[model samples]
Target: MQYAIPAPPPWWSRLLARMSPTEDMPTRGRHPRALVTPHHDEPRPTLAELYRARRLDMVRLALFLVDDLHTAEDVVQDAFAAVCRHHGTSLDGLQDPAAYLHTAVVNAARSVLRRRRTARGHTPPHAGYGPPVDEGLLLAEEHRQVLDALAQLTRRQREVLVLRYWSELTEAQIAKTLGLSRGTVKSTASRALDALEKKLKVVR
Candidate 1:
């Protein structure tokens, strides 16, 4: 004997039957459609926004590195401008814009220091020489001594120390920022601290 097949339910009925009450329910006061996959082309932050968000901190980092507020501002400005020149408003192009900017500031500060050194080397001792005044009047005694000691450090040593202590970057972070190996960072930091202690005459 042949068996008769049952007819399928109406399309509307089938659709309604397949719908679960929970599946259509809103979650945490949000519509189900609102949970959308983000698009890859979503606009990234502009350079202006990045500069606004990070300029002050960048300037401070430069200040500690270069030890001059005006030079620090110039360094930070040049860094941001360089980013803009290279990437325009598309910060997404950079793997890490903040890191890039940090490196740029460090490089720029090094250039400034190099130029200052060259200028000092060429100047005659008597040309525009002024009588020495008590540094304590200009800076607190402790501050003057600390600055004097810092000035005595090699550029790289000073940079490593400032980034390590003032900026409080980890050895790995400092290494990446300065394009040095972790071993180099550790050795440089140790030697720098030792030299600083000697300059300050701080007893262990």
Candidate 2:
């Protein structure tokens, strides 16, 4: 998966100005919140490696939310930028770095949804997808169906579904990510699932 990254102006590029380090996350066109490189310092490999590790999964998660392959990249860039902004201390203490990145991607997608109420065009369905092509994607068809079902949902529903089924985050985690109450997360996820179930039955 990937996080969101910002794009520079086309005219600026003509002057050949220094560009920020671009870690390719799957977000389409924008990045926000990643800390700018320190004026006089090289980032260490450990942190770089950690970011590299999380990028692809973040991309996948972003793709899930955005649906369009193009926009997915933009969404992830924004997420990573956000991660950079509040990248407190180190990622060393987290029990699961992947989970952290996963949440980040989800949050980024939500931000995108807020900015643009609807995602236009096709977002490839997660649940209905064929087996993952990369060595990384291990989702089965049934699982794919689950993801597909989630994809059919509105942004809020998709966010709740990812928390409940994909990330297995607690209702509290879902609430915190979506800025909803735990009760709301629980209720929304329930409703989203009910909606997904109906959609899945028809497709199946």
Candidate 3:
């Protein structure tokens, strides 16, 4: 007897599309490889330039991780402030400022969640988040459903899924950012995807 594989969800493509930043957002923010310009000897972007290019993108990322629009914006702002405090406005001596900023955003979001957990006593950090008001970050109903599913995942699972799919980070990069082994990132992503799909099926 042959067993048939289950069909993937019809909205899977749309879900991925919704997860990505807009097409016009700078590619350098997500892919560190694009920062290399040794052949042409281009100067690295200043911290201000990097912030202008990547701030919104990072906010979108933090939004997914924290599931609150205002809190997400604050998280990205704090990340930038932390980077500036450490590396200066010129971002001198930083091998990869973009990657550094990304890590900072993730860490800041984690801190926000941790504090909420301690104060709220078992409530998820995203609980009672208001609808997003930013026009640039607005989502369709289907996309909101996807985000709701993501909110149900554990923090590590959410981070792995967002970094893997939304930011399009390689497993090695994710491992370094999250301080996890590559094997753990791989397994977490697999399990997260499975859980998310089940949640989406229920939503449908």
- Structural similarity to truth (TM-score) of each candidate: 0.67, 0.54, 0.80
By TM-score, the better pick of 1 and 2 is 1
Query: Which candidate's lDDT is highest?
Result: 3
- What tens-digit string does per-residue lDDT give for candidate 3 at 1-204? 222222334575666566555666655345444442112356777788787777877887898898887889999999999988998987766777766877999999999999877867765767744665773356677878877899899999999877776676778889888999888887787778789889988988
Residue-pair clashes, model 3: 0
Q: Rank the candidates by lDDT, best first.
A: 3, 1, 2
How many residue pairs of model 1 clash at the backbone?
0
Each prediction's RMSD over C-alphas, in Å, is 23.5, 15.1, 5.3
Q: For candidate 3, what's the RMSD? A: 5.3
User: Least lDDT summed over 10 consecutive residues: which range in candidate 2?
Assistant: 11-20
Q: Top TM-score: which candidate number?
A: 3
* Candidate 2: segments with Cα more than 4 A from true spot: 1-49, 85-104, 111-148
- Cα lDDT tens digits for candidate 2, 1-204: 221212322422321222222455433234221321222243322345556655655665576576544566778777666655666336343444444566678877777766554333344455332333451233334545555666678888787665554344566667776788776776676677668668878877
Cα-based lDDT for every prediction = 0.63, 0.55, 0.77
Reference-based lDDT, residue 74, model 2: 78
